[model samples]
Target: MARWPLVPATDAPKNRDPEPPEGEAFPVTSTGLASEQPLRSAAFRWFLAGQSISLAGSAMSPVALAFGVLEVTDSAAWLSAVTTAALVPMVATLLLGGGISDRYRRDIVLRLTSLGAGLTQVGVAILLLTHQHPALLLPLSALNGIFQGLTTPALRGIVSNLAAGRGLQQASSLVASARNATRILGPTTAGLLTASVGGGWAIAADAASFLLAAAFFARMSLPNLPPRTENGPTMLGELREGWSYFSSKPWIWTVTFAFGVFNALNMGVWQILGPVIANETIGAEGWGLVLSARGVGSLLASVVMVKLTVRRPMVPALSSMTLGAVPLILLGVGATTLWLAAAAFVAGVVSEFFTVVWETVWYTHVPERMLSRVGAHDEFWSFVPIPIGQLSTPVLAAAFGTAAVAVTGGGVAAVAMLMPLLVPSLRRIEIKRGGD
Candidate 1:
C-alpha cells in the first residue's frame, strides 16, 4: 500500500481553453467541447454510462445476497454476519484502496475493480446454480467489497479530475441521476429476473454488467494521472495524512458526521426493516411499489439536480434537512396508509436534492490528489454505524415492536441531524462553484 505525500499547494486543475464549437453530441477532438461543458466529453459520458450497469448490479446485490443467505441458514445472525463480512472490509481497507486509486489511472482501477467484483458475482451465481451454501456469498461479497472500496474513491477522484471547471456540477448531477435511475430499475429488474430465472441467473446478469463496464473503461482515453505529491508517506502514512486533511476541515467533518448518521440508520431501515415493514403491513408487491416510488422520486430529483446550486448555504439546507426527516418519519407512521407511502417517496426525492448539493460541496473543496483518500475517510466513518443499525434493528423490532421502533428512530434522526447546524464550522460554510 503506497502512502500519500503531503498535499501540495497546487490549485485545483482548471481548464480555460474554449471548446471547439459542437454541433453533434460527440466531441470531434480529444481536447473536449467548450469549457462550459468539459464533462460532456464522449469519454466521460461513456464512462458514466458504462458504470450504470455496475451500479444496477450493486442495487441488485442485496436481494440476491440476503435472500440467498436466508435460504441456506435460517438464523438472522447468519445474515448479519454476511453483511458485516463485506462492509467491514470496505471501510477498513478504504484508505489503502484510495491510495491504489491515486497511484493508477482511474480508468485502469475502474476496469480492474469492476472485473474483479463482477467475477465474484459470477462465482456466487455458479455456486447458487449448484445449490451450494449461501454463506459462500459472504466471501464473494467480501472480495467484491475490496474491489468496490478501490473503485469508489478512484472513480470520484477521476471525475473531479476529468470534470474540471464549470462542468463539475453538471457532471456530478449526471452521476447522481445515473445512480438514482439505476436504483429505480435495479431492484425491480433484479427481482423480476430472479423470479423468472432464479437468483443465480440474476447474479449472473450482475456479473455480465461488469464485463460491459470493463469494456467501456478499457476503451476510454483518459489523461495520464501521475501522483501529485513527491516522495511522501508510506501507504499507512498516506492513509493517516488523508485522515488529517479530513479532520482538519470542519466543513468536511461537519457534513460527514451528518451523513454518517443518516446513511447508517437509513440503510438499515431500507435493507432490513423495509422488507419486514412491507411483509408485516403490506406485501412483497407493495414493497416493490413503495421502493419504486422512492426510486422515482430519486430519479426525478437527480435529473433536475444539475440546476440546483445552493445559493443559500446551511440555513436553507438545514430547513430541508429537517423536512427530509418526513419520508423516513412517514415510513414509520405511514406503512399502513398508501398516501403516507407516497409521502415517503416524495421525502426521498427531496432529501437527495440536498444530498447532491452537499456531495458536490465536499468534492469541490477537497484537493484533487487527496480526493480518493478523503473520500475513503468519509465512506469509512459514514458507514461505520450502519452495521450497528443493521444488527440492532431486528432486535429493536423484536423488543420495542416495529412501528414504535421506527417512530422512535425517525425522531432520533431529526434531532441528531440538527446538532451540526449549530457547529460554527458547518454554519460558517458557504457553497460555491467548486466541490471542495
Candidate 2:
C-alpha cells in the first residue's frame, strides 16, 4: 500500500497557490469565458457529466424515500429513524473514509463507492416496491451512507487536480451550477414519480444514475503516482498528522465548527419537520416545487459566481449563510407554498454562493496531499451533529410544537453562522486573483 507524504506545517501556508503533483500536467488555461476554462480539461468534463447525472438522481431519492417512509408508517418518528440510521453510520465512518481516500487512488475509490452505493439503492427500491416494512430500509440506507461518507472527502480533493491553476474557481462554480440545475429537475421528477409510478421507481432511477456515473468515472484518465516506500507512517500516524494540520489553522477549524453548529440546527428542522408541515398543508407536489425553486435560486447564484471574484471570501461566505434561516422560519410560521418557495429560493442563492467560495478557498489554500484527510476532519465535525438533530427534533417538536421548534432552530442557526467571524485569523484570509 502507498502512503501519502505529509505536508510540513511551515511549507503549507494559508492562501498558497496549489501546484500540480509531479506526475500530473497542468490543464491548459482557457482563453475563452471563465466558465469555459474548466471545461477545457476532458477529465473535468467527464467528472461534471457524471456528477450532474448522479446529483439529479441522488436529489430525487431523498424526497422519494421521505415520502415512502411517511406513506408506510405515517409517523414523523419513523421518518427520523430511517434518516438517522443513514446519518449515524455516515458520521461514524467519515474519518475512516477520509483515511482510505488519502491512502488510495481517489478516482478508483469513487468508482468503487459509487458502485457500492448504487447496489444499496437497488436494495432500497426493491424493498419499497415489494411493500416491505419501512424498518428494512435502515440497513440499506446505512450501507449507502458508508459509501457517501467515503466519496465526499475524495471528491473534494480531486477537483483541484482536475482543474488546476486559474481554472479552480471556474471548475467549482461550474460544478455548483450543475448540482443546482439537477436540484431543479430531481425533486420535481421525484414528486411526479412518487405521485404516479411510486417512490420505488424514483429510487430505481437513482440506482441507474449511480451506475452510469461509475461508468463515466471509469472513462476518466487521471495520473497514478508511484507508491511510497514501506517505511512511511502508519494510517493512525497519518490521521494524527491530518488532525494536527487541521486544528492548527483557526480559519479552517473555526469555520468548520460554526457550520457544524449551523447544520445541527438547520438540517433537522428543514428536512424532517418541513416535510411534515408540507404533508399537512401543501401536499407532496407542493413541497417538491418549494425545493425545486430553491434549486433555481442556487443555479442563478452559480451563474453569477462564474464571473465574480471576492478577495476576502470568508467574510461574505459566512455573512450570507445567515440567510439560510429564512426558509425554515417561513415553514415554521405556516407560510403559503408560494411564500415558502420564495424564501427557499433566497436561501438557496446564498447557500450556493457560500459553497462555491468556500470550496475555492479549500482548493487554493490546502496542500494537495493533505486535502482529503483535512477535509474529512472538516466534514466529520460538520456532519456529526446531524443525527442528534434528526433524532431530537421530533421529540422537541412534540414538546414545544413543530412550529416553535423550527423557528427556534432557525434563530440558533442564524447565530451559529456568525460565530466564525469572531476569529481574527479567519477575517484576514484572502483569495488572490487568478488563484481561485
Candidate 3:
C-alpha cells in the first residue's frame, strides 16, 4: 500500500478521465488495465479471506427469513411490513453511521457492527429454533437490518484503504464479484437448509459469518482517514452540508437520482417477489442456477473490464446502468421459464457491471476524506426510494397482480432512470475514465 501522507492525496476516481472532442483519439491504456495493487500481501490476503467467509454467512439470512415468514403466514401484506420493518431502520441510520466510519478507524467500526449483526442473527435463530414466540423474528430481523444499513457505507469507504492505489479498482471489482459469487451459494444453501433442517440453521449460519467478519476485520492494518470537515453541530446542519456536497457534483447527483428511482421500483422485485417467484415458478434449484448464471456474467465483466481496455469511464458506467434496465425488464417478463430466467440472469450480470464501475467511479472521484459522508449521501438518495417499493409492492401486487406489478416496477425503474440520462451534462460527464 502507498504510504499515507499526513495530508490526503488528490487521486480522482478511476473512471473520471478528461474527455476529448468527438473525432479525437481517446487515450488508450498506458500504465496497465489490471489492478497493480498487491493482493498477495499478508494483510490484504487475510482481509479477502475474511470477507469471503462473512459473505458466505451473509447470504443465508434473507432467504431463511423470508421463507420462514411465508411458512408462518401467507399474507403478502404482512410480508411487506416485515420487509419495511427491516429496511427502514437500515437506510435511516446510514448517514449517521457513515459519519462514524469516516471519523474513526473504519475497521473498528466494521468489527463492532459485525459483532452486533452476528448477535442479532444468533438470537433470532435461537428464538426460531425454540419455537417460542416466532413472531419475535420481525424485531430481530429489524435489528440485523440496522447493522447492515450501518455497515454498507462504512465498508464501502474502508475497502479503498485495503489495497494499493491501483488496486482500488480491482478491490471494487472483487467486491462485486464476491457479492455475485456469494449470492449464488448463500440463497441456494439457505433454501436447502430451510427445506431440510429449518430456518434456524440458516440464521445460525448467518450469525457465524458476522463473528468471522469481526475476527477478520480486527486484524486489518487499514490507514486512518481523517474527516474532510466537521460532521456539523446538529442533525439538520450536517444534513445540509451533506446535501451541499451531494448537489455540488452533477455526476454524483445524476447517478444518485437515477438509481433512486430505478431501485425504488427494482428492489422489491429482487428481494420479495423475486424470491417468491423462485419458490413458485422457477423452483429452488432453478433459482440457484439462475443466480449462478448471473454470477458468471458478473465474473465475466470483472475479467473483461478489469483486463480489457476501457475508455471514457463515466460513459461506460452510464451505458451499463442504462442497459441494466433492459435485463430487469426481461427478468420479470421472463420469470416463468428456466431458460428465460437464465437469460434474465445474464441481464443481471450486465447490471452488476454497471454496479462495480460506478462504485469505483464514486469512490475515486469523491474525496477520500469525505468518501463515507458522500457515500452516505449517495446511498441515502438512491435507497430512499427502495423502502417505498417495499411498502407499495404488496398493494400493487394485490391491485394489479404480482406479475403485473413486477412488470410495472421494472418498467418504472427503466423510465425513471432515463430522466438523468437525458441530461447532457450528466450523460456527457467525463471524470476518471481509462485504465490504471
C-alpha TM-score for every candidate: 0.84, 0.84, 0.79
CA lDDT scores, all candidates in order = 0.69, 0.81, 0.68
lDDT of 2 by residue, 179-233 (tens): 8887777877999999998888889999999999998988765666457677776
RMSD after CA superposition, every candidate: 7.1, 6.0, 6.9
Off by over 4 Å in 2: 1-36, 67-81, 131-136, 275-289, 330-339, 397-404
Clashes of each: 12, 1, 10
lDDT string, candidate 3, 68-87, tens digits: 66666655666667776778
lDDT of 1: 0.69
Give Cα distance to truth, residue 129, candidate 3, Å.
Answer: 1.1
Model 1 lDDT tens row, 240-263 = 667767887665676677767776
- What are the runs in model 3 whose C-alpha is more than 4 Å off? 1-36, 69-82, 224-239, 268-292, 327-339, 391-412, 422-436
Deviation of model 2 at 40, angstroms:
0.8
TM-score-based ranking: 2, 1, 3
Candidate 3's TM-score reads 0.79
Task: State how far residue 43 of model 2 sits from its true place (Å).
Answer: 0.6
Q: Over the full model, what C-alpha lDDT does candidate 2 score relative to the true structure?
A: 0.81
